[model samples]
Target: METSDNATAAEETTPEPERTGIAAQDWATASAVPQYRAAVVDLLGALAYGELAAFERLADDAKLAPSLEDKAELAKMASAEFHHFERLRDRLAQIDAEPTAAMEPFAKALDDFHHQTAPSDWLEGLVKAYVGDSIASDFYREVANHLDSDTRSLVLSVLDDTGHGNFAVEKVRAAIEADPRVGGRLALWARRLMGEALSQAQRVVAERDALSTMLVGGVDGVAAGFDLAAVGEMFTRITKAHTKRMAALGLAA
Candidate 1:
């Protein structure tokens, strides 16, 4: 996986998606295709619903930010999540599928993931959005290569435009460094968030392997087979990114 450190990459990626409204039937598929049972479908539903809630909740939380600068940036990011959620929901519909109901089975476990790991402060919120969303975007970007073209395009589109979330990365790190005391508290909070995330993921497997099986399909190795490790690695990178943010802020990692 190649990583770019330049802001130009950020600039190149964030073209405003022209807001042509979703097609009349974009939210529902026409033919009753069998692909509905695939782990892929279930995963999409889980991801779709999560994005819907994340967008709303994050938008609300942005109000908690101290400055209009932070508030505006975070709100933009939250709105983008809503765009992504709708794109996914519309794509699900085009498959002639039930978006919310398909998403229902995995809802509780996924909701539990967010509820248990909710952030407590402004910097933490930025880290959660920057680190968390970017990691998920990367992993989904990778997984998209395995899917059919339309689904792949839909996934790629949703993952495409993260307008300088890396900027937030730089800002948060600077904030933490400017005040060394926040380092331990935010770092500890980051770990707690990751732990709750992992625990909820395991519970998903223990209780809802149907969705789990649908998520990974037949990836390859035992560790990769129906395991949450891929998602965990995403979270691991989130922590690594958080470390970079902290260090940039002049705080100890």
Candidate 2:
């Protein structure tokens, strides 16, 4: 009888499975660490602002569309981008972070990036939508690898293609086929966008201590072994992805 009682007690006291990676833990488990919480807030804030900016930019870019069909497609993508922004904003508030205040720090940087990389025409707009936005998405997806499961899921969901990539690819490829000279111009534009996007990303990391620490030193068990070497490798991967995107668009990387 005593042995049976002991066995029951042992089973009742059994520990939960150990969480081996950020993906194994939910936001409630991972956000217990102050630094990790701060890092997540910063990450979400930046992403929220980026989505909002993309929404606005795509709407404006629609004005440059060569046809009403193209304009309507861009409008649809802009709505999707706005929906993404709302998700991030709601998540921030659910975590008790002020949505606008959290997003404020990143607003200027994202605004400047858009201002600097403003596309001149319909084809340039298509290329920027495909190439520039994909670069940013790739970077965020890399960062998402270190996020807690809940946050990671939200981030990945919002990053889903809003049919923009295929739409941009079809339009840009058709333009290039129609005029090979357009391919060279767009390729040069894409390269410029890559440089600016990387610079903006580095600037954001440098300015946000919590985010930079999360990337370099990591927090809690997330990105536990991440280092400078890993950062270099991440960028190399992003560049390789960019080259493939350019190739798909019938442009030189």
Superposition TM-score, candidate 1 onto the true structure: 0.70
Tens digits of per-residue lDDT for model 1 on 37-156? Answer: 344567578679768867866787777788898788767877878888888788778766689886887788767766766777777776565545544454455454444445656776
What's model 2's TM-score? 0.89
Query: Candidate 2 on 91-160: residue-level lDDT in tens?
Result: 9999999999999999999899989998889888877877777878877876777778899889878987
Please give the lDDT score for candidate 2: 0.80
Candidate 2 residue-wise lDDT at 144: 74
- Best candidate (score: TM-score): 2
The regions of model 2 sitting more than 4 angstroms off are 1-19, 221-226
Instruction: Candidate 1: list runs displaced more than 4 Å.
Output: 1-37, 202-253
Please give the distance, in angstroms, between residue 20's alpha carbon in candidate 2 and its true position after superposition. 2.6
Q: How much is the lDDT of residue 33 in candidate 2?
A: 81
Worst 10 residues of 1 by lDDT: 18-27
